[model samples]
Target: MSFRAGFEETWRAVLTSRTLVSTMLLAVVLYAFYYPAPYAHETAQRVPVLVVDQEDSGLTREVLRDLAATRGVRIVDTVADMPSATARMRAGEADGIILLSRGVTRSLLTGAPGGGVGVWVKAAYLLRASAIGEGVSAALAGAAEHRLGSAARAFGLRTPVRVIQEPLFNTSAGYKDYVFPAVASVILQQTLLFGVATFFAGRREQGAPPMRRAAFFGAWAAMTLLGVFAGFFYFGFIFWLQDVPRGGNVPALLLTVPLFAAAVAALGLFLGGLFDRSERAMAVLVPTSVPLFFLTGSAWPLDQMPAWLAALAHLVPSTLAVHIFVPLNQMGARLSDVAGMTMLLAGEVLLYGALAGWLLTRRSDTNPR
Candidate 1:
């Protein structure tokens, strides 16, 4: 088949096959809503916390008031002792506990080393626990500062330095903003990968002849186009609707999309050539999604991964694409900033496209259409 004929045939096959349509198109839409549903609130808010105020002093009360007013925490109830606070946490009544020890007020006022505030968080959910810890810590810090400031003023002295914190990129530091952008790239790769693999594998199962160079390129192009569409759907609409942090360099992001899609499509075509049946493609590829996501270094840093594993991760298109897209779309990085990685992605397109073409060409020789 010629390039145009192969392109048209692949498009027709994709549109006609219920399996392909569901895997490629429907799955993208479904995941766009489903994957991010839990993170809809963006950041944890008003996380219930129990306060164990062993010292019911005026200072402790002021700290509790500030803690209750914080966006991340709410003082659901004040308990008499540590045992009661622990019981409430175990019963799921609160996400965290704050203990103002008997001499905490004295410690703060005198700068003594004896008694201090203690925080206990149910670490079952790290993000919730972090929010609770941060909120409680902030309140305690404010109280401590106020006590110290009063003493400083009495002595006619001033604090030499004050630290101001400003979060970068994901300013809210919400789980959705931190995670969804990277996962979106994985979704784009996996969907297109599964779709293309299933499509070509099904053809092989039906005893279809192997595609020539032009035909292979044509089919690859078709899949690449679909992948690009799915990517933009996430980058353009879903981010906006979900209110995930965005506003990166749009033109740079646009330029990166096709390179990412083409590389994934080529990888899919190559993997599809190995499968004799569509079922085999799904069986092998489905389980790989989670592992591939980890390899992207979004949830975990590549530097911390074993050196070999980190190096190997670069072979996956989504890894490179995540690095490229996250910086461009989320961090507003310039094209030149991501130029090296973009070039690497283009290299993947060449490497995988060559392998896929060679494999298909060999198959054509044996099948002898």
Candidate 2:
């Protein structure tokens, strides 16, 4: 068939195929709203904490007041002992407990490292624990600085230099902003892969004739277009809806999208050739989501992964896609900043596309029906 005719045929097939329609269109629309709902607030706020103040001094009161003033924490109760605070935590009334020892004020007055502030957090959810730890640390740091600055003034000495932190890229440092961009790259690859695999698997099971070179290219082109359409929805609509960071250079995104889509489409076709039935493709590919996502270095650094595993991960286009897309999409990176990953994705497009074509040709030769 001519490329035009084959392209028209493939579009008809995609329209009629339930798997392709659902994965390529329905899933993207539904998840665009659903996935980001949990992180709408960005970070948990005003976590309840109990304070055990054994010092019972003016200085301790001042410190406790400062702790309560922090936006991330709420001092729910001031208890005399650890047992009371433990009971509150057990009762679900508090997320953490802070114990200020008796010698705290005296030690500070003497300019010695005073009795420490003990922070106990519920580790069941690490995010909550982190917020609690950070809030407590900030409060204690403020108190220490106040005391030390006063001592320095009395001694006619200058205050020590303190570091000022300004978080860039992710100004709020929210989990949703940090994670969604990476997952978006994975979603683009997986959905396109699953849809193409299902379509090809069904075709093979029905004993479809081997495709001519033009026809194969036509089908690959149609799938790549669908993948690119999905990418538009992700960056244009979904990212805007969820308020995920987006300052991607238009040319950079336009440059990368087709290469990423084409590579995924070729990979899908290559995998699809191995399946005997429609369902088998899903069975083999669906479980790969978790492993592939982690392998992309979203959950862990590539440098930290075992050498063999890291090398194997780099072979998949999505690994490089995540690295490239996240920076461009979330961090507002230029094309030059991501030149290396762009080259890798372009290479995968060539390699996977050739491999897919070779597999189809080999299959036709073996059967020759």
Candidate 3:
């Protein structure tokens, strides 16, 4: 078959197959709304916290007032001792407990060594824990500065150094904004791989002949085109709808998408050649999704992973694509900034394309037409 004919045939097969349509096209649209639904609130707000005021001093009272005023935490209850605060937390009445130790006011005023503030948070929900920590820190800082200022005035002392924090890229520092952009690349790869693998594996199961070189190339092109469209749908429209952080270099994104798509499509075709049944493709590949997502290092640092495992992860298209797309789409990175990864992505296209072509063109007794 000619390249154009193979391309048209693949497109027809995709459109006509309900399974392929659902997996490739509709799933992308469905997940765009579904995955980000829980994150609609973005940042955690007014996390409930119980305060243990052992100091019971004027300084500790001022800090409690400031903590109650902050948007990130709410002082749901105050207890005279740590045991009561711990009980409230264990009972789920509050997300965390802040303990103001005895002599805290004296420590702040005299620069003494004994008193301190202790924060105990439920690690069950990391975002809530983080919110509570931030809220408490802000409140304590305000209280310390106020108390110290009065002391400084009496002694005619100089102002203490203050630390200013500004969040980069994700200004709000919300969970969704941090996670969704990285996951978008994984979604694009998995959905496209499912559709492409199912299509070829089904053909193999039907005892179809090995594709001619032109036809294999054409089929690969068709799948790549679908992947490109899916990438744009997530990066362009879905991001805007969900209000995830974006506005990266448009030209760099344009350059990166096709390379990433072609690599994934080629890799899918190569894997598809191994599966004689369509169901086998889904059975094997579905289990791999979570592992592949973690390999992207959005949730965990790659440096922390075993060196060999981290190196092996680069063989997957989504790993490199995540590194490229997240920065290009959200961090405003220039092409030069991601040039090394871009070149590696292009290399995967060549490596996988060659493997796929060789695999799909090899005739076998089971696939004989």
Candidate 4:
């Protein structure tokens, strides 16, 4: 077969194959809508907290008002004691409990250790817990600063240094914004791999077709094009729709995207060639998603992982691709900044493309059954 003929055949197969059309293309669209739904709000808001004010002092009241004012938390109920607040949290009416002891204002007034504020947050959901805790702490800090206003200034009791915070990226500090870019990279690799695997595994099970140079390279070209299409659809349109932070380094992305897609497609073809049946590819590859995700060093830092494992992870394209894509796509890194990973991705394209082609062209008896 000529390259043109092979390309046409592969294109037709992609159009006809449910695995490529529905599972890969349509699924990417569905995932775009569904995956980011939970993150639509960006951050949790107005988390309910039960306030217990035994002191009934002006300071405690001020703290309550501040808590209510913050968008991150709301003063859902004012209770008289810890037990009642605890019960409210347990009943799911409140997400946290804040307690002001009886002598809190008296102690502050007398310059003696007298009373304190206690905060109990539901730690099961870390993000919610953090937002609630930070909100309450800010309210308390502001109230304390206000109460000590003139007296502390008169006594020259102010700290010499003031810390001002300005977050450079992920400015809203939303969990979705922080996590989705990394997850999207993994999704691209896995969906492309699975779709291609299913297609080739089906071919292998029916009986190994005569390996022609054109057909083999044409399949590779077709899968790479499909993979690139999937990458752009997710990285371009989906990320825009979700309002995820993205950089416009088109040149850097253009270089990285094709390399990553080609490498993933090559790897899928190699793996698909190893499988004797269609179901076997999914059974083997689906379980690898989680392990590969962690290996990308998004969930856990690569330096912190075992040295051997970290070294091994570099062999997987995503381990390197995430580093390249995340910086180029989300962090707005320049092409020069992503040069190393760009080289790595290019290397994967060459290495895997050669391996896949070699495996496909070899005698069927040599391939695993």
lDDT of each: 0.89, 0.84, 0.89, 0.82
> lDDT, candidate 3, residue 92?
88
Candidate 4 per-residue lDDT, tens place, 26-124, comes to 877887788778977777888888888998878888888888899889888889788888887999998888888988877766657869878898888
Regions of candidate 2 where Cα sits further than 4 Å from its true position = 83-93, 106-111, 150-162, 363-369
Which residue pairs does candidate 3 place in steric collision? none
Kindly report which residue pairs in candidate 1 clash with one another.
none
Better of 1 and 4 by TM-score: 1
Evaluated at residue 167, the lDDT of candidate 3 is: 79
Runs in model 3 deviating more than 4 A are 154-161, 364-369
After superposition, the stretches of candidate 4 with alpha carbons farther than 4 Å from their true spots are 102-116, 152-163, 364-369
Candidate 2 vs candidate 3: the TM-score winner is 3
What's the distance in Å from true for residue 76, model 2?
3.6
Clashes of each: 0, 0, 0, 0
lDDT tens string, model 2, 78-117? 9979998999899999999999897887786675676767
lDDT of 1 by residue, 9-99 (tens): 8999999989999999999999999999998877788999998988899889989988988999988999988998899899989988989
Residue 308, candidate 2: alpha-carbon lDDT = 100
55 Cα displacement, candidate 4 (Å): 3.2
The collision pairs in model 2 are none
